[model samples]
Target: MLLALLALAAWRAWVWWEAREPADHAPAADVRIEALNDRISALRGDLRAQAQRIQQADATNRVLRDELLGMGQRAALIEDSIARWSDPDRHGAQALRLDEAELLLAMGQQRLLIAGDLDGARRAYTLAGGVLSGVDDPAFLSLRQVLVQERAALDELGDDPRVRALARLQAFTSELDRPTDAVPVASAPADASWWRRAFSTVFDIQPRHRSLAVRPADRGDAMAGLQLELTLARAAAERRDVEAWRTALTRADAWLQRLWAPSPELQGRRDALAALAALPLSPELATLGSTLEQLRQLRSVRQEP
Candidate 1:
């Protein structure tokens, strides 16, 4: 369109020059035509320069578009790699390390809070310490401290007089299998000849020097009394009644001493009971509940997105 317009303007200039040309001012008309041609040439050059610039700009845009696509592909690859690294099933290095810690924490919580297994809980806490040792993130610092505090609490429980006495007393109950004052009669010796055994049995006779062993008609009453004492001790321990527990232990000890012969194990148990009874019975530890709750809260917050 610009070229067409330039052509039209040139035609009009030529007609005007022809009309004014009366064989005079021929040189001036030629000069005006040359000037117009030069202006048209300059205008054409400017249009070409603009077109080249536009082409260069389009090429640059394509390069930029391709770069963006390559970048998108690279970004997708990176995202996939990250997902694989963090996936729980994959158990990548970091994931496995963290999972061990979490599992230990969960186990500890389950044992201490639900099952009331102090030994199991302590083991879990110890395992957690090993797992968490490698973790340096500030986010887990509180959890680590809580675990330490919990382990310490368990240690304190181990030292608690009431708990110790209860455990020992419970063990002692199983050891009371021997009836203190009771003895079993020996069976008669077998006779070499059937006739001789028959004759001895028929006469209900033995050697004149052989002594008869005495057997109780029934020892149910004695067994019942012992069982009752043991039950009372266990119940007292469960109730955390220090006085009742002591009384029950004392009665049971006296009953055993009266009926049974003293043995090494029995002596050891008595000594342990005496030592435990001497120490002041500690009240239930309230710190564990609050510590566990704090740990649970921390775990939940850390799990949040």
Candidate 2:
């Protein structure tokens, strides 16, 4: 019974030791848990700071993206300005060509209307067409067609009227320069009486119906007058003065009639003069300056803002 009582006391002592050991470890566990809690708080703070830094970086990225876009737009604008400054007259050559074409067209109209130079006017029109053809713009393409039609109109005129008139005048002048045949005088027979021969030589008798012969001095003066009239007609033709040309030709015809006896050759010369007077000095072309007008309109439109 004493041994059993000693065992019971030992068991109670062991139980008391176990319970005191737990109480001794409790403070260390509290210290470790507090340390862990502090570490978790520090981690949470770091996480929040990292999230704030990410938000700030996103805002900075957005600002940088907008700035980059603005910079790109500015760069594009600057490039365009540089290009404009570098080549101020990008269409200078074309403008010069258009000017040349306009000048040529105006020259053609003046040549045809004022100088009666059909060949010169035709050549000017052709050169204008060539200049217009060199233009690269499609807007002026119709001008080329108009120019072509003008050229065709010139072609339809055939030979130059001034040239024809001048040629005819030249031929007539050459004919006038030729020596005219003198009238043959009848002589008395070889076997006639001396008195009859003497009378024939002393007194020349002609048919009453025969016209009076012109003296050499009068013939020369008349020829000069006719030549002056012919020259006036030619000048009028060159100047494309229809009224002046007709008046001069009419005066020349009158002079011709007064100077020369009525004959086949004389009539032919009169007919030629009449024909030259009838020839047109300046032919009317409906579409002569249409191309130039159209080109000017196109230029004006292009120049507008």
Clashing pairs in 1: 180-259, 180-260
Clashes of 2: 0
Candidate 1's TM-score reads 0.36
lDDT of each: 0.65, 0.81
Q: Judge candidate 1 against the unseen true structure and give its global Cα lDDT, from 0 to 1.
A: 0.65
Q: Write the per-residue lDDT of candidate 2 for residues 1-305, one digit (tens) a residue.
A: 99999999999999999999989999999999999999999999999999999999999999999999999999998987776555423347887899899999999988887776788998999899889888888878888988898899899988777777788888878878865444324467789889879897566675576543467676667778889998998888778788999999899888777666565666888998898888877777787778778878887776643
Residue 145 CA error for candidate 1 (Å)? 1.9
Q: In model 1, what lDDT does residue 12 have?
A: 100
lDDT of 1 at 213: 29
TM-score for all models, in order of appearance:
0.36, 0.53
- The TM-score, computed over Cα atoms with residue i paired to residue i, of candidate 2 is 0.53
In angstroms, give how far residue 258 of model 1 lies from its true place: 16
Clashing pairs in 2: none
